[model samples]
Target: MSTAAVTDKRHSTLRAASLPRWTPWVIAAGSLVLGIGISMAAGLDSQVQWGLIAAVLFVLGTFGVAARVEGRRQAKDRVATSLVWVAFLLAVVPLVSLIWVTVVRGVKVLDVYFLTHSMGVVADTEPGGGIYHAIIGSLEQVGLATLIGAPIGVLTAIYLVEYGRGRLAKAVTFFVDVMTGIPSIVAGLFILSLMLIFEMQPFGFAGSLALAILMMPVVVRSTEEMLKLVPNELREASLALGVPKWRTILKVVLPTSVGGITTGIMLAVARIAGETAPVLLLVFGNPFINNNPFEGAQASLPLYIYQQFANSAGSGAAFDRAWAASLTLIAFVMILNLVARGIARWKAPKTGR
Candidate 1:
């Protein structure tokens, strides 16, 4: 054969064969059917089990089919992609289920009446109570915690990133690391110890203190990361203009990373907002509406949920209330996250003006 014919033959042999776009979908459908059949034959009841079996079959079938038709390299790539998708679904399934369950169960008692009133005279088993008291307590405690924690956390982060040096800085960093891993119960216990020493009672402010302990480490770590991301060139530029060091950090570095800082603070707030152990230990939940967080035992959302469940003694009313409170807590956290993103967007440093 001539060189032209040989070249054409080599090119044809080297060209990869492409599968139809719908091939994977067809394989998945077949795998699902087979998995269902197997599950039925083995008398398996759980949908989760069938899903897992289907996922496994789909992955294996894809690899085997791809290897035979396409090539080993293509098969491996397909397998990796399949695994990633499977992992994503596995992670999402539980989250979706939790949200679904919450919505279904919570809506049974989550009405305007439930939100506006409180458990003032009503018993847990009777079903005529609300979360107004818990809402007040949660807001006060979390707000107090944020007020006490955010500034301190931000300042500490600034110090660590900007001016920290030697043993003191290292010690601070080490302590912050240690605090970050400390359990919520431990933080509550720490505050409890202080309360015992001072002969203090459980109040909203005590929960605030425990929450502050938890919030500070998160805020410090997140803010430190945000501050680090601010380019040193901005600081140098400001300093070159004869600006003071602190002023440069305030005007240049901070402004540049303000969005991230706010996001971090909001995230820290969210992290502490849902904590039940600390609130239970420090606030010592009360059923009656107590607006003054500084004076008496307070009811927070998490604590309310716990109390409802515990005090219900297997009453449907209590379980329903717990679910509603849980839903409300989830909504509150979601709102914080949304607000954080909004602030980040609004305060994001302008470019290309």
Candidate 2:
């Protein structure tokens, strides 16, 4: 035989057979049908069980077919890929279901009228109330908490990362770790106890303080991580140029990590926005519009939703309003996240190699 022909035959013989891309999709569809059929035969009612069975069947089918056509190594690789996809679906399915249900139920009563008006005189059993007051209170309280928490968090993180030493840094870090795990209710109770001592009435700013407490630890952790990611070379270069340590941090270190710090601040804001315990204990959930957060009781979205559901007993109007309020809170957090992402992208350091 000619050398060229021999080489071609050898290469062709060594090449392993691979499955078509559509093979997985076909197997998935078959697995789904078979899983449903088996569930029906077993008289099972759970959709979750059907999904689990389908996922198992899909992975098994991929392994079996690939092992038969290709080698066991290729089969194992395909199985791993199938398992990853299954796990991803398992995680995402529940989130999509929740958002889908919220949208379906919330759209019934969420509109311009709902957004513009307040609960006012409408009873929980009645259908005419809105979340205007709740929106205002949530905004003010969360904004105030952000104002209180963000600067302190950034400064603490800067101290820990840049100038930390000896027992002081360890103590500060230990406290931050403890604070991160502190329950939202505990923070609320702490503030509530202080309010009692000072004879302070429940007001919007009181809730803000509790929220700020919850926010600070998260900001500290996130900011610390971000600051650590900044290369030491940059700091050394700045110091070599005769820049003071504080000035180097303010001008270079902060600007380099500003994107991440801003994102952390926004995440902390979102974390506190939906808290009902502190607001319930402090703000007291006002029904009427209270534009001044520092002076009066306020109605946050969470408190409004909780009140509606708790007081309604079985009222459909109250349930609808609760769902609508939940949707609004979800939207607010989502907007904060989107804004954070935008700011992070905008402020991210440019790279030119």
Candidate 3:
């Protein structure tokens, strides 16, 4: 090669034709407009149909335009990205819509007064009632279930992770797997059968037992995973220091994975918090306040909502109460999730590079 040609080649940069950074947004807007026009022209009234058309058009347009400009390889990558965005919007739009609708309908009856009073002496067909009793029942029942389930679950997980061996361990693992898939209604029925055998009446404690059954497998699975995340090096170090196995687990392993374990327990609590069938089959749904969970029927938010909606005689008041109770339950679950996130972040082991 000549010296001038070699120098020119070293200094030159290869460039390919590519779309602008804003090309996707422009394509999406155009597709949306075209989708709406097509839907209207075809006399289709479904917004979902319009959205599907827009998503399809956007993906097709991106692939075609990118292939023409940037080549087929880049076009396929763009198509994958487009597909991801479409799936994300598909998931998010319905969730946003649900929360929006719930908030709008819930605020009609949700107030401080609603949170403070019971439905004592109030007809389900009337407008004057509150979820105060339900709140009390839910708190007590879930608290009891947690107290019952969390420790046993954690201990079982510890056994599985640290000391599991032989056929016993296999049996425990098998049962945990089986329990994880047991329906809430089956738990309720099992408890119900015991109550019948003992000639007992519906009470809040019975509901708590069912919730505990539904809660344990989730706790066990999550806690087992968290315990496994604790590095073997930590356990080995403690053992090398002449520490007892139980003490080492308590001091080193448990502390290291405490955040994840706590998060799992909180999530388990949230899962059992919204259960209606167990509460219905056991607690029997009270209309008035019942503070003692052991002795009598009690109300829960889920049961309250179900009762109000199912029993109302074309009454707007009952429907409003159901929505308000739903809002409260959602708020409670959201708070638990937020708290779990906070605890996880705060107690998570700090990493150093």
Candidate 4:
């Protein structure tokens, strides 16, 4: 081939057609306008219908335009990208709507006074009480459950990852899997059966026992995964230094994975914090404040929300209290997640000097 012809071919290959950065925005605007026009012409009243139409139009328009301007390959890529964006928006919509509704309704009743007092003598319809008792019950129950569940779970995970070698290990693994799938209500019922046999009445400690059951499997699974992620070379190096297996695990392995373990524990705590069925079957939901978890029925936020909503009977005040409690519970869960993240970041192992 001639030198000029070779240069022309190389330049042509390098100068492939490219779309402008603003093309997606232009396509999206056109799709929205077209969708709105079609909705109006069809007399559609639902915003959801309009949004779906716009999403469909956006995907179709991007494919068609890219095919014409670029190529079939580019068109398919654009279509896939558009579909992913649409899916993300669809997933985000319900969460945004839920948070918005909660904030609007909850602020009507959430106040310092509402948080500091208890529903001692007030009627649900009248709604001049607070969730202090419920808050105390939740903290104590979750704290106690964590104390009981986390250690056992960590030790089980350590055994499974480090020393598991026989039928005993397989049996433990099978049972952990079984426990993972056990429903919260079933756990509560199991505890309830024990209580019945022992002639024990509903109390906060009973609820903690049920929550601990729910928490243990989660902790075991999370901690096991974290331990497995630690490099085997570290264990070998420790053994070469004449370190005991237990000392190696306690001094090196545990510190390296402590951040992940803490995160998992927080997640487990959040999972149990909002449980209503177990609390209902065990704690029994008291309206008045009771600090002792060992003896008397105690209130929890989830149970309080349920009771308030159930007793509302179309009463606005009662409904307001329910919404406020729901908001508080959500905030508590969110705070736990944030704290977990913070701890994970803070305790994460340093890789280099």
Clashes of each: 0, 0, 0, 0
Candidate 1 residues lying further than 4 Å off, grouped into runs, are: 1-18, 313-315, 349-353
Q: After best superposition, candidate 4 residue 43: deviation in angstroms?
A: 4.0
lDDT of 3 by residue, 242-311 (tens): 9999999999999999999999999999999999999999999998899999998999999999999898
Candidate closer to the true structure by TM-score (higher is better), 1 or 2 = 1
User: lDDT tens string, model 1, 1-353?
Assistant: 11222234333443243567787888889999999999999999999999999999999999999888766766887789888988999999999999999899898989999898888998778877999999999999999999999999999999999999999999999999999999999999999999999999899999999999999999999999888888778899899999999999898898889998999999999999999999999899988999999999999999999999997775588889999999999999999999999988887664444
Tell me each candidate's RMSD, in Å, in order.
Answer: 4.3, 4.4, 4.8, 4.3
lDDT for predicted candidate 1 compared with the true structure: 0.91
Supply candidate 3's per-residue lDDT for 211. 97
Q: In order, what lDDT does every prediction score?
A: 0.91, 0.90, 0.91, 0.91
- Tell me the deviation in Å of residue 170 in model 1: 2.7
**lDDT of model 3, residue 5:** 26
Candidate 4: which stretches are off by over 4 Å? 1-17, 350-353
Writing each residue's lDDT as its tens digit, candidate 2 over 215-288 gives 99999999999898788899999999999999999999998999989999998998899888988899999889
List where candidate 3 sits over 4 angstroms from the true fold.
1-17, 313-315, 350-353
Which residue window of length 10 is worst by lDDT in model 4? Answer: 1-10
Extract clashing residue pairs from model 4: none
